[model samples]
Target chain A: MKIYIPNSAFLGNIDPFLRGFDPSDPGTLEITANEKWIAVHPAVLSMITALGLTVKPENISCRKLEARSRHYLVRMGLFRTLGISSDISIMEHEPAGRFIPITRIRTSEELSNFKNEMIPLLHLEPEQSRTIGYIVSELAWNVLEHSGSEHGAVLCAQYYKKSNSIRIGIADTGIGIRASINNSYSAETDLEALRLALKPGITGTTRREGGTEQNAGAGLFFIKSIAGINRDFFVIYSGDALYKLLKSPAARPRLHADPFDDRHSRAEGLPRWSGTVVGADITLDQTAGFSALLDAIRVTYRDAVRERLKARYRKPRFI
Target chain B: MRTIRLVEKTGAFAENKDVARALRVDELMPALERGEEVALDFTGVDAATQSFVHALISEALRRFGGGVLDRLLFKSCNEPVRKIIGIVTEYMQEGLAPGE
Candidate 1:
């Protein structure tokens, strides 16, 4: 079987790989570049590789894979890691930024060692190192908490020293934000799910699951706030919703629904991303100290935290 | 008089499970039994999450009441680490039962 990746606005076009996949089939698989110019999200690439890994096929190869762009380089690394290689110069091409290859965090050991692992890769100072550390920690924790993907979560990050910025991406082939939130409350649209997920106390974790004490549904909330305060760009794409928060001095965090298409009507025009991708791009120069960033969050949301705690503790444990 | 080095127990980026494993309640009972104040040293830890902070300190708060927080001193916490410990500790104190 051969899968062709397109050079489109986004890799939302790559969902067809999950179709008709057979675990026991021994068929050889090939992934190729379908267009002259190709760019893909690490989340989509991770999902494709994960699908190929799951079907347990005889062999996998990348044919005519182009490593022109930085994104493609990372995807090449991912393909290489999955034992897929092409007889092309793509392997020799270096990605534009210092890209951390896609990582799989399944065990507690991997998750705990994330900071130590990424620090040298990031080559960040103690302060900037701690900033990304907290960000990635919260993101990884969310994957373990909500993403029901059996294969675990995939993470990729790129540091652009020249631009003084870092972009970190984490995705899981699990139930996306819509399903996770709609399980508790009725979120009729993907945009609604994305919106609700940003609320301070709106967590998908339930009372019976020991969520009250462990989760305050503040992970994304904190991420959103920190990105905004730092004047950075943050994007959360899950299910059919693609919410991007571009940092502006006077901007309020708002979900700009896709004006081109409405999510509720099933007459599909664009393909939907299968999993959750939380991508952040923060400019290092404008970034505050990691501790001050967290402190700002605490001070800003202290009232919100108090309200959530009151609601959580007021309920009886078993009733 | 008993000081637990957080870096020795957990690495720079400490998780909740790691924090729990590093400083189990049973491990601290001996120090408390000897009437020694248990101080958690954060000399080498770079960052901590709220959940990790809560997991590490909640047991102590439960065993010795909110006042036990006073006996437990955090040493050499960086600004971010201190903020995490402070936020979690404050919330835990408020959520405790009236006497606690």
Candidate 2:
């Protein structure tokens, strides 16, 4: 399920009948505002506000105040209403504020136009913006590759100007994460598929170049680095298993690896996975080197085109 | 319609001296002179400095004179992208709220 269900009503305070996990014991399971909504459906993006939020884009404010679990959606709608260009970044009162809403558009042209319009809003430094763009470009392309059945996906973003943080979301009405994972490796369970995805080269594409780049897997790796330093977080859901990355040491790679050319066997464990809708939450930790982040992203803007190049040529000679 | 692009990729999100020149007179003057619908694309694009992106967007909207443009749309975006949009817009409305 998405972090949010569009048109969420009922004030979202109702207790939900959770599966797999129990929510009764507060001591055992710490329920944040997010957890409460996730219990109903993992895809819920929660917004906390005492009063209904007012969304301003360039001009007209929403005449009627409306509340949403995800303020991000409302944010975009207001942007559309006010007729702001894509180059503008929306700011929250605090570095991290809430209540966003976005409408799901149903066309590839529309998708392309929206992305082009919204890319400038990250409020990222020139460098950091590149990295964030790399992340967005990679994920957005994946949806096109994996979800060809659908015209395209709807994406929305939120940037915490104060926290110096941003989160980008892309969702499509196509195959979920499990199927994508299943296409790549022999994973009997959706959870297993999720685990395999976290590994460096477990891709479904038959050709080396065609598959998601090993370096591309590094996309998550680098995002993790930023989130780790800054205490940011990311999540991905595909198929049935929902995977949310907690920006902690357990989820990251060590500084050095033992160069196991032997390829004897993989590590003892992989990221835990379950069936989930495919979406990711990438949050930058507060302390990450903004320059490093920007530098890394800049290189991507210049070189990330390699992923696109790989798509051409039947042999897929290079990646 | 005014087109807004997420410029985190490169090229001033496509803003330039020509745009500055255009802005010196009226922000939309350049786009209008071209007889084009303003459109912004986030395709293969990335983040922009928040203030930078906001300022550009507001200026573009201002040029539209409240309704000359058809519509401003954000394309092929992700959740993180959506979140950033929310933060900026909410901030703008804060000061102008009727109660405030």
* Weakest lDDT window of 10 consecutive positions for candidate 1 chain A: A256-265
**Candidate 1: where is the Cα deviation over 4 Å?**
A1-34, A39-44, A50-52, A57-63, A70-76, A90-97, A178-193, A206-216, A251-274, A308-319, B21-36, B58-66, B94-100
lDDT of 1 by residue, B1-100 (tens): 7888878767766665555545755556567656678888888777777667755775566556678766778899887788877766665565556675
lDDT of 1 by residue, A22-64 (tens): 2233365566664467665554455556545544444776665
**TM-score of candidate 2 to 2 decimals:** 0.43
Please report the interface RMSD of model 2 to 1 decimal.
Answer: 17.7
Residue-wise C-alpha lDDT for candidate 2, range A1-319, written one tens digit per residue = 1112233221122112112222122122111223222212112322111001112232222222233333443344523522333332446662333313343434433434554565554545555555555555545545555555343544555655555556555555455555765665567755555555544323455323213211123333334334443444444444444444443444322221111211111221222212222333444444444554434333332232343344452683686
Question: Cα deviation of B2 in candidate 1 (Å)?
Answer: 3.8
Best by TM-score: 1
Candidate 2, which segments miss by more than 4 Å at Cα? A1-73, A78-112, A149-151, A207-230, A249-319, B1-100
